[model samples]
Target chain A: MANHTSTQASFENQTTWAGGRSPFNVSYGKLMMWIFLLSDAFTFSTLLVQYGTQRFSNVVTPITTKWPDPASIFNHFPFMHGLHLPLLFVSVMTFILILSSVTMVLAVEAGHRKSKSEVARYMIYTIIGGIAFLSCQAWEWYTFIHEGARLDGNTFGITKQGYDHLHSVGFGDHFEWADGDRTFGPVPFAALFFIVTGFHGFHVFSGVVINVVVYIMTVRGVFERRGHYEMIEKAGLYWHFVDLVWVFVFTFFYLI
Target chain B: MEFYNKPGDYDAINYIPHTESHGTKELWKTFWLLLGITVLDFVIYFVMPASGWRNFIFIFFGLVKAYYIVGAFMHLKHEKINLALVILVPMVFVLGLISGLLYEGSALEVMKSM
Candidate 1:
């Protein structure tokens, strides 16, 4: 009995040593998630700050300056033209993302309960939600590209000039006036729009991939062997982070 | 040492994992809260004036919604208070940075207009 007790104690000590000590007593995965989120927060902050600066500087431009209203800019379908629908597509995208976040939370809940089927069901729903968001983003991008917003010379009519030009150029020069109708060329605004939204879309894409992997593992009962769905909880954290970023985007980019 | 192998040791280390059914209730509550805040956001957008009172209202509601989403949905509320502070402090700094940038940009605009 003594030898057996000693052996168990030794094993426990070795296990503790191998695991290393956490400063906050949190799990390794959770700690890493926090760190990753902190860095991501910085990236988003910089993007928003820069966007605000540019927007504020442009606001002083004269009313004649043709800054593309987001409503007009985003309202339309790619290839299937003349839809003239404002924010309809984006609204659908937002709904999908938000719904997916809900499903992800459910999945995390199922994992906590150790219900394999429930967890798998919710995970699949989350994956579909993610895919829907990506599809909407793709359409948004395509519509943006098709609109012919030029990244080069005064194409679409929005100029990056400061307030000084507001008096001289007015808002009309801000928009492209050609062939008796105002048209936009693909230029700086388009470029910036693509870069920011594209980056966000990529994050969504990555999130979908992560969800799919987790879904497959859950279906295969991998997490069951471990007796928990901690992995799902971790992935849910990431999904929520993406959703939080979109809240800021909706406010700053779309509404503001 | 002896406590480590006690019958309730596992329970001590791990939170009493709420059942999936309980989690569903939590999820629904979160969804409703989010919707409420979104409605409030739209109200602030349209109903409030652009300056002074409106601006204050918008910012206040925005922060409230942000906190709700982050705190409840993101599980920051379940985390240690210190950890929550770590995340929130940086966000506050970001807001300050945004305000500073807006101010500077406006200043430059005024200068050029002059």
Candidate 2:
């Protein structure tokens, strides 16, 4: 008993970050993944900050407002062509992402249990969610481009008359921009929209690919031979990070 | 200490800490919370006119959603304190950067007007 107590005391006295164990108590891959995510967060934050700066710099004046209200521009829903449906489509996109995030976490949880089949199942659900989101973004981009928004230019500069017309229409009302209601707006508006969402869509696309690869690995019993499923956990971290970034993109881009 | 000093035997590459299933109760709870907040965001977007307060609310909700996603989904809540701080502390500076640049942006607006 005395020796056991002494051993316990020495263990308690040992430094937490001794060279043997991970200071973070996580595996090397997971720790590196966290660091990578921190850097990626900075990337996304810088983009958002640039967005905010561009928007605030183009404040509405008595003459012309450069920044267009997202609602006035992104107020279309699939199958509801002319009706004003601000936030509806993006809301669906958000739901899909959140659902996918949940499924990814579920896969991680199953991985912890070494439940191979369940992990694969949740991974499939997550991949489907990602594909769905990508399709939605494609439709949205097509619509925006079809509406004449371009990388080098923006046609969404709402005139005073356009503002008034937009205000007169209620949610779900049939609304279209009348002539003279729009002018060439700030170039960064469309450009940043494409850049930010395009960057995020690319992340989602890669996330889908990663999920597919991990799914294949799981099916091949690689993890079973390795005696762990931490790969799913690592992929889950990336997946959740994507969802986290979307929360902000949804906030700054659409809702605000 | 001497036993630990042999780095070659440590196998850092494969040293995954043991993990266990903590069940899906909390995860599902977090999902509901995120979904409900999103719904609330939608409702408030339509209900409240665009204003500073509305923007503040949206940002606040965004942060809350971010918290749940990172904490529950990423399992940061169960991570070591050092790990959590290392990951989260730098974000405080990000908030500072956002505010500072926003102020600068407004100043630029004034300059453009001038």
Candidate 3:
């Protein structure tokens, strides 16, 4: 009985705060990646919190003080010009991000199985998805800028008549902003839109770059020689984090 | 218990936990779940009239999407509880910040009216 107790005590001691192994059971690199992601999350949350505060402070009055309705401003669909397709384009963008996130995870899983070609293939798919999302964002920014939305000012605030007109138009119907409909509204409206989404877009761009580098490394049999594909797992964590941020962005920016 | 007398003998930087393929089935399921929730969000946006209730629903769905992404896609669910807590617990403060500022924001609106 004394031998059994001693053996169990030593086992417990080995697992707790041991100098040789990580107490968290994660590698050094992966733990750093998670910590970096946590810091990034704080950054994004601060931005979003500022956005919510600014929006709430500008109470929706009859005309000038009202925050612009996102659906009215973001109703454009690519190749379907002059049609008021509210929420459709952004939905497509969301779908692209979600799809790419899946591909990234698939690549990580394939790496676990030591399937070189499969990891490469999935990484390529993920890179394509990131590029596609970036393109969609480019078009969106262009359309917004073209509509007189600037970083310092916004002309998308719908007047009472404008709000009525916007409500009258059905989905996919031809619509244009009449002269009396728009007035200069809250400045932070356009500013926050650009800042938050642009930040996310930059992340997608970097994620694409990282994915390409990883793809090249995989092709060169670097991981095979190292006997582990842990790099893919690290990159996968960043990719999925970007997706997680978008879910909140979609909710607060467009859906709300 | 044996201890490494030299730091070079224990390379912590090169240490990685052994990983295994849990199959693509769970990953694909999570993808579909995320997709379905998004579709539902789109549908509700069109079907329901805008109200506090609608906004609440949207926020709820967003949380659900976030859970699946972090839990399944990021593999946090399979990680040790200690790691998960370390990553997630700080987010509570963010939530608190959001709620506090939103209230303060509404109060600012009242002040502006004055």
Candidate 4:
């Protein structure tokens, strides 16, 4: 007991709150961000799992109009209209996002070196990459609404034809499906597509907003004044997580 | 009061925070590996015949990319084990949810047959 008293006194010099400088010496904010991201990951995982369940269970015997093929649905690139570039534009978008991640890491690295300009430069590049990715998403959504494969009148939303009938018969506005032909399949597939991808798009949009705010802060010398760029590093963690989720979405939705 | 780190020498920066700088070499290494994996995924999708194994390959490559992003880009590889577990443990639940639903789906299919 006498010997333990000396060790207890030694810890008195250490902050009682930290209990020896945090487990793994992790910063409070970063740890909290990680926890938040973990929760977010679970949310996304559930959506995707549910999507998989519905899709595979609905696989039919004839296979004429199964679930929509993503490769065909998302095969357009900007300015190359009507071209059949399967997964190329999406791949470009993926690479852009990955490139932004690399730039973010550079920004964090520069921050470590206390190079304000370097951090700002890399941060600007990262923000631009985010904007590019958002633009791609917009193009994708536009193409989906106007040109991508549709289920038409299928009960399960499985048919990929009938767009020509819509145009030839002056069914311009209501291309989704005619009520008379609704027995082919239901509309769950399109609804699910919008829900899942819309959810992901919303995340990316929010991430871009966060990145813009952080970019403004970086340019304004806030981190430099604080003498640490951990702020940018924290933002980088979030950006990377967004990119990571996209990796899964791209595979499950498009490539696979 | 806000805590801020003092600036370190350019060369010494990586050593000061006990956190390695995301050096260009390390960043590019991961970037190339991830890019290559994605390209391979596309190739396999195009060249290979559709089968049960194809989906598994896609998942395998996807997992590899996820590991890299988490480890290198997110810097979790360098983080303490306690901190890493903060994310890893919950992921078990995610996996459970996925596998459980898949099993349930198969069970339902069997029921339909019977």
- lDDT scores for all predictions? 0.66, 0.89, 0.89, 0.72
The CA lDDT at A81 in model 3 is 91
Give the distance in Å from residue B82's predicted Cα in candidate 4 to where it truly belongs.
1.3
Candidate 4 C-alpha lDDT tens digits along A39-74: 889889988898777666655445334555556556
- Provide the TM-score of chain A alone for each candidate, in the order shown: 0.78, 0.93, 0.94, 0.79
Write model 3 residue lDDT over B45-97, tens digit each, in one string.
99999876898899899989999999999999999999999988999889788
TM-score of each prediction? 0.78, 0.93, 0.93, 0.81
DockQ of 3: 0.51
Q: DockQ of each model against the real complex?
A: 0.29, 0.50, 0.51, 0.39
Weakest ten-residue segment in model 4 chain A by summed lDDT: A166-175
Q: Tens digits of per-residue lDDT for model 1 on B1-114?
A: 343323222322332232234447667787777767666655565454344355455556556657766776677887767778877888888999987886686676677678
Per-residue CA lDDT of model 4 for B6-96, tens digit only, reads 4432211122234556567888899999999988987787788556588778877998999999998888998878778878887977877
By lDDT, the better pick of 3 and 4 is 3
* Residues A116-223, model 3: lDDT tens digits: 999999999999999999999999999999999999999977788888889999998999989888888889999999999999999999999999999999999988
* Ranking of candidates on lDDT, top first: 2, 3, 4, 1
Residue A211, model 4, lDDT: 78
Q: Compose the digit string of candidate 2's lDDT tens values, residues A56-110.
A: 8987777666688896789999999999888899999999999999999999999
Docking class of 1: acceptable
Q: What does the interface RMSD come to for each candidate? A: 5.2, 4.2, 4.2, 5.5
